[model samples]
Target: METITKIVTRFGGVSLLPVAVALLAFVLIGAPSSWVTLTIAGLAMGMMIFLMASGLSLVFGLMDVMNFGHSAFISFGAFIAASVLAGLSGWLGSDLIILNIAALFLAFAAAILFGMAAGWFFEAVIIKPVYKDHLRQILITMGALIVAEQMILALWGGAPMTVHRPQFLEGSFLIGDITIEVYRAFAFMLGLAVYVALYLTLNRTRIGLLIRAGVENREMVEALGFRIDRLFVGVFMLGSALAAMGGAIWAGYETLITPALGGEMMIVVFIVVIIGGLGSIEGTLLGAIMVGLMANYVGYLAPKLALTSNMILMMVILLWRPNGLKPAVK
Candidate 1:
């Protein structure tokens, strides 16, 4: 085990896992253009998953809250963003880029705002009573998720909603034989920007310091007069907002969404969190990227195995490193 750890560390650790997977895929694919296209698609998909899962990771890792209802935010965010874009169809179809940008911004803003508010309420009302009790947390959160899905059904009906994209994000870019969707590129950039902001905030700021300290020793921090409960609520809210933003972007990616979107994505989000080491943001990103790449590559290579690829990956990873690739220091 020590020898394997040393080898991985020598080779730049698990961050290179994606690169290694990409290289293997390139060799198997044997076509430069196809490989490039697949790689980019995988990266973009990974970023979207990261956005959705990062919040769940933090909530569970730091707050010790098993929020099975997290995916409810994803569903709500997608629907809210889609509704906003639908209402602003004129702006989306306008020739003016400014209107297009405004419409897009409003849709995302609404989703984020709704997510934050909902998260705060959930934390305060549903979660507070279940603290430190894993079984109750799971049961209540799952019930909350079911209720959320029913709410979506009531609001949007049973039809699969079509999500319209702004003019700016409606096309694809071609480079030689490699083609990249503009929306995918936008998603990747947005996810990366969020990651940078999160990394800096968690590792470099005073609030981050307090959060980390609270995570390590909540009683000590509370004794030091730093309102840990309030900080936890903020963390929950941030996580929920991120999930909503991710859903909004994913809605555009899928172009069609249903009430089941959250349920479908919940499994993938949890897989990423568990295999990525619970509360570690970096680990979540790594797990998400690897899942993305593996899914795409497997779908192309062996369609029958694609559905189970992530589960297989998780099993193998656990067998190799049970603690996950980059677990946060407790």
Candidate 2:
């Protein structure tokens, strides 16, 4: 095993795990029909995980801050989405089916605004105070998470809030013999659009380029007369907005909103981010894709041990590369 580890490490630990995943997938997909179904499911899951981790990557990259409360923002977005949809349904005098369009639009807006609110608060009070102190940010955000949780409980009660699929989005879309949920299809498209737009912004736009450069050397960028403080605001806001969008989509998928949703999702997000790298956007996307597929397949193989797959991957990656699969060195 040690010799095997040394051989794999020589080529980069990142390649080793993914290579393992590929072989496992190849084995599982020996049958054509089952393989196609699994592939579609994996693709759909990968899209959402990518978006979720993208936000986390951006924030961590520029700010050198670990937003432990990001999961709370996700919960905030989900509940806000549910509340908006419910309100829209009431206004239309129709069921969930009748109001999906307007409901989704409003939910998107609500999630963005709520996410911005979380970012602003975090940046001003908690995050700002802990400049180079990751421990402080973690502690403070954990406290904020508790308060946020309690407040949610007070406002919405402890019962789970279920959202019914809009009439148009209720049924599954059958492509041949495989049935795919209409909403998952919608989420996948949205996720792709978001990823493309974000990727372009990071790679093409001037602001995006500056952010990338800054992530490489914050002090250098600052010394070069770039307006880093303003850029930080933009980065934080953008990350938060992405987080909210992901939350709204997630709410649509599950059709239920709970205060604990963020906490539960947080574990996965953390695993994805850590496995991918601390400050690498591309790493986030790749890690998300692997985790998403691993999760679904793990559940199929061992329902009780599903969550362990993600954490186990993260542990293996950390042992091999302490900085992660992709660290923002360039």
Candidate 3:
């Protein structure tokens, strides 16, 4: 097993799978315009998925917590962001770009703050007692997810809510025969920014070093006088915040959200996290891009295969590399 693991890890060291798949897709699709459009759309979609999945990966990889209720935060973020955007319709509706940007920022802020608070509360009230026990963590978190869905229904009712994008973000621009939506571009940039920020924080900062060390050996880190518990709590809060931010961005992309939004997206998020490697942000990005591209390409080429594409992808990848494309060393 160890030998196979080493070989797989070595083989997966360089991240070119997504690029390889994209090239193959371009050839198979055979339409430059259509391929370009689909590829951009896929990248945008994958970035959003990465945003949502990154948090879960971190928590799972670092804290070893099975948080089935993570989706609740996503739903909450979408609803809250939607409400904020609705209330700020005047600003969002304004033709002024600055106002539109402000409104969007405010909405995202509200969602992230709410997510942080909820995450802290969840960690303290529900997760603290179940440390190191996967079964209890799963059971309790799943129950939490159920209750959260109910709460969402109670608060927002059982109907789909529509979200309107800012005036500047509602349309598309054409580059030759290809069209790119403004909102999608924004999502891609945002996701990329988050990824860069996270990468730097994890790889270049002292806090990130502590977090990594803790992940590898919690006892060793704590023995060095750093309170690993507080660090972990902070991680949970950050993870929840990221999930909410992703939800907010995604809500704008979809233009419609329901109480079960998070529940529905959970599958994709988990798949991305799993395929990307449990705790690897880079892997998550690659996995997300691959899934996104696969979905768009398959959906365009064969609609029937779209729904099952991710599942098939996961199965194939797992068969090739059991620990995922880039599993955390710890």
Candidate 4:
């Protein structure tokens, strides 16, 4: 085990996991074009999931909060973005690209803003009292989730709402034997961009330094006149906003959403968090990408095992490294 860890570390550690998985899949599939298509789709799926899971990773990993209601932000974001796009159908279908872009921006912005506000409220009202109590945190968050679902049903109703794509985002880019959807490409780029931004913010910025410090020694940071509580609130809000953005993107990817979207996604989101390890952005990204690639490859090669592939992957990874591929240092 020690020798294998050293070998993996020498070869860029777990960052090479996605590439390794791809290589193995390529050999098994034996078709370059199909392989390429599936690979792109998998990456896109992974990115979207990363967006949803990243925040929860921080909330659970760093803040030590078990927020089962985190999915509420996802559900609200999807519904809100869908509603905005629905209201801006004319702009979405317009011949003008600027209008389409504006509409798209507005939809995502609304989702993010709502997520931030709702997160603040949730943290202040429900989560604040439950700190350091995992059992109550779970019970309260679950209750909050139930209420959120009810609220969503009351507002969006029981119908499945169709999400609209912008004019510029519609269609596919054909390259010889392979056809790649423009939306998928956009999603990949957006997710990659978000990951880079988050990496820089958490690893490079002053605010990130404080957050990490607080996690390590809250008493010292507090004694230094830093408001640890406010910092945590900000962290919670940021996490919620990220989830909302992810949900908004996912809504476009699915093109149709129902009130039960959050409930359905909760399991997958939790899986990604657990797979990535707590409090590590890099780990979360790695875990999400692995799940994405595994799901797509398995679905294509063995349809019957598609649903269980992630669970299997999680088990294997845990058995190999119980703390996950790259857990953040405490």
Candidate 5:
């Protein structure tokens, strides 16, 4: 047990597993251009997943809340953002880059605001009552999810809605023999920016210190004159906002929106959270990238196994590191 603990500890110090996997895949594929394309696509997908999963990870890790209905926020965000974008179609279609950016920004902002409001209600009404009760949390959150989906159906109808990207974000640029979509590049950059901002906020700020301290020992933090509950509430709202932002971005990525969007994405989000280790942002990012790469690579190499690739990856990783690549609590 001591030896095993030491090994896990050693591995936890550095995040090299994902890099090793990428290198192995590159060698196995034996096609530089194809590998490069897959890698870029994988990275973009990973970033989107990271945006969605990061919030859940933080909430679960810090607040110990099992929010099964997180996808509801994602769906809501998508719909809200889509609506905003649709209303601003003129700006989005304009030839000016500034107008295009403004339209996209407005859509994202609306989605985030709505998500924050919904999160507040969710925490206040549904989640707060079931604190520390995993079974109840699951049941209640799942029930909320079903209701949320029904609400979406009523609002947006059962049909999938098409999402249109701004003119500037529509096409792809080629690098040698490789084609990279503009939106995907934008998504990757946006995700990276968010990750960097979050890392800084959590590691280099006082609020972050309080959040971590509160998570480790709420009583101690409370005694220090901070309102731990309020802090947690803020965290929940932030998580929901992030999920909504992800949903909006993903809606544009898919160029279609559906009520089932959130539910469909929940699987990937949970996989990322679990594999990355609950509450560990760095772990989540790495896990998301690995999953993204595996999906793209496997889809191209063996289409039949694409759906199960993430599962297989999860199983293998769990077998290797039961607590995940990096467990915040541990």
Candidate 6:
């Protein structure tokens, strides 16, 4: 580890080795037969990862709490949207615009409230005492995840709820020889906007500046005028809200919400946070792209590889740069 760090420090991260290796990947295996489709799918997958990781990264950044329940929020969002659509479909003629608009707004409101509650409880109880202890946080959060999962099962009945694609987003568009789903395009656009908004919030606002400061030196900020404690709560709320938003968007894409999704998806999110570095937004983006692309591209070659690609990526990145893509700034 010391030797690798020394090498990176001396040679710098922009060395030719990475570029050469990247070129080699494309050379060894040229673009797939359906290169365009594959590329589009890969991009879409990566963007989804970015959305999920954004929330995870922010939570870890401020609270230092790895809320595995982030996935639960996603499940909740999907379920909420699915349920609303289901209700509307039964009475109304299943209009796409109305269903989508209704689902989106309901999901958004539900998610915000749910997320805020989660954040408040976490800070008021589990996290405040163990703020500085990694092991304790891990155990407590794991327990919380299990509890949340059970609650989901009890509430949603563990059924696989499917989301009906509205008429407007149900089909695809033909472009020359290829076709593209309208929903996928919408998802991409939404993800990009979320990313941009997060970046601006982190880099362009006073609250954001305080967040950066708090992350760097929580005690120091407390020593000053600001209420570092409330800041923690605010950060927690923000993170949870982001996760919930991702969940809601995911509901539209998958059209099915399952209780197990929280546990299942949380693992990937954990990897994203670790591989991308604890709190660096840039690292999270790059890491998500890497993980997302790996999953999509490898799935094309082998289903098994697709399932495990991100884990492998994590191992490789940790081996090469154990601190992750971008280590947290002090």
Give per-candidate clash totals: 0, 2, 0, 0, 0, 2
CA lDDT of every candidate: 0.94, 0.77, 0.92, 0.92, 0.90, 0.70
Error of 1 at 284 (Å): 1.0
Query: Residues 69-174, candidate 4, lDDT per residue (tens digit)?
Result: 9999999999999999999999999999999999999999999999999999999999999999999999999999999999999998999999999999999998
Write model 6 residue lDDT over 1-330, tens digit each, in one string. 777667766765623333333344455447633445555655565576677777778778766775655676666655665666666563324554676566556655776677668767866787788777888888887777788778878877867877765566667787877667777777778778878987899899998888877767777887889997788788777777667667766777777768777677777777878888887777777676666656656776567777777788889789988778775663
lDDT of 2 by residue, 92-149 (tens): 3456543656766777898898888778777787777887898888898898888888
Pairs that collide in candidate 3 are: none
**Which residue segments of model 2 deviate by more than 4 Å?**
1-23, 90-99
TM-score, candidate 4, is: 0.97
TM-score of each: 0.98, 0.89, 0.96, 0.97, 0.95, 0.86
**Pairs that collide, model 4:** none
Q: Report the lDDT tens digits of candidate 1 across residue range 1-330.
A: 778779878999988999999999999999999899889889999999999999999888778999999999999999999999999999999999999999999999999999999999999999999999999999999999999999999999989999999999988999998899999899999999999999999999999888777666778988998888899999999999999999999999999999999999999999999889978889999999999889999999889999999999999888888978888853
Question: Residue 176 deviation, candidate 4, in Å?
Answer: 2.3
Give lDDT for model 4: 0.92
Report per-prediction Cα RMSD to one decimal.
1.1, 3.2, 2.2, 1.2, 2.1, 3.5
Sequence-dependent TM-score of model 2: 0.89
**Superposition TM-score, candidate 5 onto the true structure:** 0.95
* CA lDDT, candidate 6, residue 284: 76
lDDT of 3: 0.92
Write the number of the candidate with greater lDDT, choosing between 2 and 5. Answer: 5
